[model samples]
Target: MSLKGKRVIVVGGTSGIGLSTAKAFLEEGAQVVIASRSSAKLSEAKQTLGGNVETYELDFRSEENAASLFKKVGEFDHLVITAGEGAMGDFRELPVDQAQTAFNSKFWGQYMTVKAALPYLNKEGSISLTSGVYGKRPAKGASTLAAINSALEGLMRGLAVDLAPIRVNVVSPGIVDTPVYAGMPEEHRKSMFNAIASQLPVGRVAQPEDIAEAYVYLAKNGFTTGTVILIEGGALLS
Candidate 1:
């Protein structure tokens, strides 16, 4: 289960949970490659990761771009996709176009990434995807988010069966303090985090590092497949 010298690729790894997951792999002595669509973010990640990893500018939404990415990478041991943005709003009022975009990025994007990466993946390797707690314990005004995450988990299960021996799994994390919420007003954001934290038994909101560990575990554990590891601080219980 030791990751030393293993080749791991993390798509959408420039910031937030993706960046933290890359750092965790590095700490375990793995050869890490981080990919993002933004070249500027990639540069920042390189510096943050202490310059020992490879960086690729990848737009996972496009099949061609994803294929090009793996072509450059050649072959890799594990593929982790923590990219994609989810939309949050009332189902009735939310714009249909925006919801479609969310699904395209978060659900279809990961799907394409997996398809592109499979050819270049080692037979013994694994694929870890990202999901969210809303997929299971949805809240009001987050119907679209729930659908996207739920679809991802379903996809993972099917993939595990179809691509046997090459483990496929997902990490379903609850609220985490990542840049994904940067668009909200500062005060409102803090207030929201505090409100959720109070309900959780953990008594604190999760950080990127907290969720990052789940990805690491999924990659290292060969026996675990078609699983959704919930690192949600007992959110469903609360």
Candidate 2:
């Protein structure tokens, strides 16, 4: 789908899936804006993208910041939010503050971004949010993540109806090899990823580019809304 002349905003676009999505949109001739909390990362991303791309330093956890950032961003054809924190641990053992922090950063972060951007979005414009496979299927050591993911999906679906002419959807990706997992214990991480890859019918984990196609698809398809597209490499089927 051609996005020539379209203006798109990608929150959390400094790295991983969001960064990949921004590049894809730019390659399609769309004017892209990338927002994140890190100025250093944003600068790096700008240098990497190298064009007329706009960069904004945004802290989604702060409602004021979110509103201000969107206001400064003005209007756009698409708003994609991939900003979130991944908190893994047993719910009972996890600190309440930690869970709340995760929720504030991811769930409410996306909510505030959408709420702020809705008025600025053109008619038939789309809002894409990110969830995860754990939202649909439970996993060990992911209680907080699961809850937040499920909440994000529900938020998008409800907003789809409320937003009406504007579309809302979520992308749920599983086991993508990204820098986010770099902190995991080497041996354990390797085993975990291998196990995940082996279980999938596709015989491999996903990449940022793999899931990026889904985001581009949803953005271009006007009739599709209130849906969560899973890019789990068939892991959901297994």
Candidate 3:
């Protein structure tokens, strides 16, 4: 339950939900390790995290990279993967290569990390993967994202059974205010958030920290596994 002194590794931890999850784990007195593909972003995240955690450069798409990460980390108590690039566009217009890349990066990336970490992961440990609300309540142009998310949740369920005693779960967040949207023009981004907020019962989009808490809960709760904790501003309800 208590995370004090437990080791937690967060993949894709350089920004967005992953970074916030690292911060949250630190707050709970866990020993946190953050990994991502960008060294520069990892450096920035290390600084942002107050330089108290370990940083690893990991492109989970590479089996070697994933293997190297656990080798260097030795062993850890929890593995959280929040790194993924979603592909958006009408299914008809979406390029097959783009969809494949998205799947490789998000779905297979996490898969590879899990495979690499299993031997090094403590038997008491847990694994948390990221999904999205689109898997359940998809909209136009979200076909690829929906498929990827659904696959991840399915994987979680199977893994929980296969890796019994070592819990596996998912955090399926709705739209959150994170750097993933940094490329959007400021006005358009704000407008989009506002428009979505009006429909949600919560009256606002989620912050990365909001979703971060769910990850924390998953790590601390021993009885929960094979579950998808949706922190989506009630988007499915709306």
Q: Runs in model 2 with CA error above 4 Å?
A: 185-187
CA lDDT of every candidate: 0.94, 0.89, 0.94
Q: Candidates sorted by TM-score, descending order?
A: 3, 1, 2
Count steric clashes of candidate 1.
0
Q: lDDT value for candidate 3? A: 0.94
Clashes of each: 0, 0, 0
Clashing pairs in 2: none
The TM-score of candidate 3 is 0.99
Q: What is the Cα-based TM-score of model 2?
A: 0.96
Clashing pairs in 3: none
- Per-residue lDDT of candidate 2, residues 1-238 (tens digit): 4689899999988888999999998888889999999999999999988868899999988888988987898878999998888688887888989989899988999998888887789876899999999988868888889999999999888999999888999999998887788888999888988998889999888888898888889989988999999888877689
- State the displacement of the C-alpha of residue 89, model 1, in Å, after optimal TM-score superposition: 0.6
